[model samples]
Target: MDILDWIQNWFKSNCDGDWEHGDGIQITTLDNPGWDVEIDISKTSIASMNLDWILNENSKQDWYGVKIENQKFNAAGDSGKLIFLLGLFKEMIEKIENNTIG
Candidate 1:
């Protein structure tokens, strides 16, 4: 499936309550000639955990232009940013499936 479709399906199956009820997940283009992906984790099972701690402790791989704040994560870069976001998203979904997120 396409990345967008896969993302929608993932949220549909894994997200609790109405996933689209708020600023849940946002994917948009950036003026810096790149893509941006924002994910709001506050509504997820990992809501209670520290966002910074989660990134530092779990995502060891470096994401240069990514930002995590208040249960939200935003990644922006060139065209490659899409791939990076996809990888991060997949890993998070796996963690969720494995009950690894607190």
Candidate 2:
């Protein structure tokens, strides 16, 4: 399957609480307040630079924000809902970047 399909499957049957899937993307609202997870996939090379998202100071080190194979690691924050989501997204992105999309 492609990245979007993989992401859809990932969240389709897995979530802490209520969730939503539409427009070819998956989203899970955190059980806690002020947090949420939005995941999507692209069918083009990561180098294409058309994902249409940005990473600011608060999101620079985010899972989907950071670029794969970048050696410069920056300390962002602690473990929690955001970090958990980050781990998931980062892993998925890495898979595609490394030509191991499955």
Candidate 3:
């Protein structure tokens, strides 16, 4: 699977509708070639978390982040979601670097 395909699978696996529908995360492709990824997540209190990644050409990887809204729960709520996002992104990057996809 390529990076994009990997990402799609990762997100599909983690999708959960039971959680408090805070806000659906919106992912956008940056103007740059297909490497840049932008994430806009809605948090509580009408606030939002925005992140951008500039994937390295060599590693086929990048860094991204998000701030948990409300943050009533610990990482379980916020961290878990953020970590899942990062993990999926990392997994996708690795798949691309290794050229491993089904």
Estimated TM-score for each candidate: 0.65, 0.30, 0.29
Best by TM-score: 1
**Candidates 1 and 2, the one with greater TM-score:** 1
**Model 2 lDDT tens row, 6-90:** 6556556444344334223334443323234444333224433333333433442332333322221111222234554456565
Q: Please, what is the whole-model Cα lDDT of each candidate in the order they appear?
A: 0.66, 0.41, 0.37
Tens digits of per-residue lDDT for model 3, 73-102? 111112114445545545544564576843
The TM-score-based order of candidates, best leading, equals: 1, 2, 3
Error of model 3, residue 11, in angstroms: 1.0
Reference-based TM-score, model 1: 0.65
4: Cα error in model 2, Å = 22
In lDDT terms, how accurate is model 2?
A: 0.41
Clashes of 3: 2
Q: How accurate is candidate 3 locally (lDDT)?
A: 0.37
Per-residue error (Å), model 2, residue 1:
29
lDDT (Cα, tens digit) per residue for candidate 1, span 1-102: 767777778678656667568788888986646677888777666555444423322232333366567777666656555876766766776697698866
